[model samples]
Target: SQQGEEDPQALSIQEGENATMNCSYKTSINNLQWYRQNSGRGLVHLILIRSNEREKHSGRLRVTLDTSKKSSSLLITASRAADTASYFCATSGPGYSTLTFGKGTMLLVSP
Candidate 1:
């Protein structure tokens, strides 16, 4: 598949701790985007780092991309209970309007 799969289907962490998730893809991509979805809600864009970029950070979130390995990782620092959600990595086709997503990593941050 051209899409990526995240390791560890689920992750649990305490408030104020850090959480990390990794994604592996089979094909080259233009860019990779990380999104967070609250329970039964729409996904909120977290960050986008292109194939040419190595690392990017947003607020308490950090993302790293390794195009040569066709993989990426997302790190959430000092996570809070509100951060509990499903995280997905998305990449779009050059002309397609749809984005392909992996099964996603479920994160639960307990207070």
Candidate 2:
């Protein structure tokens, strides 16, 4: 069973700055995904890259995967107050339908 774990449960960044977070997993996976939740809102999928992928980028976000190390990192460049939210890493594969999510990384972009 693969389980995701994130470092620095909370992060504070100045508006217009960049924020980065890391995640580690226990087992092999088919794919890894990153999601964002705003307060009480449901999570919105940020990105998903397969195991064969090394890196992916979307808008102000960049994600990297190091399967050999079983670790991943998410970077949000030029963040804004609107980026204040909880970020989660999820894993899927090996007879798993629902993704196993990390506790989460709460990002606070101060105005």
Candidate 3:
């Protein structure tokens, strides 16, 4: 069964704007990860936030985790047309040795 599910299913934004995506999980997780996939390319790891962590940042990307609510959010600042891609949320922990990925959120950034 899938542990995580991304909300909004799709998002549309203009260049230089900010985009936000959210995820909710079903079970306890030691860590949750966000990824981006550009069309035919493979998914690229974005950030992994531990259960103990509330937030993380890398470049223009910001991620927040709330284990108590079993939810997380990803924010991309200064969105660009190049930032257009599908984002996925995945989770793994405890008895799970593999990650379970959500269906993904398709983001379209217009120039």
Best by TM-score: 3
Candidate 2: where is the Cα deviation over 4 Å? none
| lDDT for predicted candidate 1 compared with the true structure | 0.89
CA lDDT, every prediction? 0.89, 0.93, 0.95
How do all the candidates rank in terms of TM-score, highest first? 3, 2, 1
Q: Which scores better on TM-score, 1 or 2?
A: 2
Model 1 off-target regions past 4 Å? 94-97
lDDT (10s digit) by residue, model 2, range 10-33:
999899899999999988988999
Q: Is candidate 1 or 2 superior in lDDT?
A: 2
Quick one: ranking by lDDT, best first? 3, 2, 1
lDDT value, candidate 2, whole model: 0.93
Error of model 3, residue 81, in angstroms: 0.6
What's the residue-level lDDT of 45 in candidate 2? 99
Candidate with better lDDT, 1 vs 3:
3
Better of 2 and 3 by TM-score: 3
lDDT of 1 by residue, 28-79 (tens): 7888888899998999999988888999999999999999988999999999
